[model samples]
Target: MMISALPPGLPHPPQETERLKSAAEQLETSFLAQMLKSAGVGEMPEGFGGGIGEEQFASFLRREQAREMAQVGGIGLAQSLFEAMRERHDV
Candidate 1:
């Protein structure tokens, strides 16, 4: 049988590929969280339930929500990022 040669620095090990995928997802999650925070999704008007405490913890909520969204196939950003990295690294 003939063996095919991989391009230099391309095609990481399975574990490394998994790590890259996780990192891409995390990056996407962070981006989504920032977008959600900027859109004021977790904000509340004055005299409502939101206050200093809520503001302080709003980021955490946004991050969790973003993570869930990414896990559930969010905005295709993660996939795009993963594919780009794979191509760049020749993986």
Candidate 2:
């Protein structure tokens, strides 16, 4: 009599739901952090240019939001940024 072999189950992989939840959590955290930073609720180290005020914090938040939006979904923001910078300096 011949017997069939069962597949190995040693490699446990995360479920799709788990992965989605983790990704959502990360995005939420990033969004909140960006919001707080822009609102000036966070701290700024010494000798870091201007002081951490409402205006500065708000500006930071805006930039962060834009960056995050551009970053998600594999849009290649990093590559685009690099190309932009490279265009400025040909050397």
- Tell me the deviation in Å of residue 57 in model 2: 15
Q: Where does candidate 1 have its weakest 10-residue lDDT segment?
A: 1-10
lDDT per residue (tens digit) for residues 1-91 in model 1: 4324358666678875796689889999999999999899788776787667888788889999999999999999999998887676662
Which candidate comes out best when scored by TM-score?
A: 1
Best by lDDT: 1
TM-score of the candidate numbered 2?
0.33
Q: What TM-score, over all chains together, does every model reach?
A: 0.80, 0.33
What does candidate 2's lDDT look like per residue over 1-91, in tens digits?
4322224433223453344344454455455556656666545555565654755775666666645654563344344444443333332
- The residue ranges of model 1 lying beyond 4 angstroms of the native Cα positions read 1-11
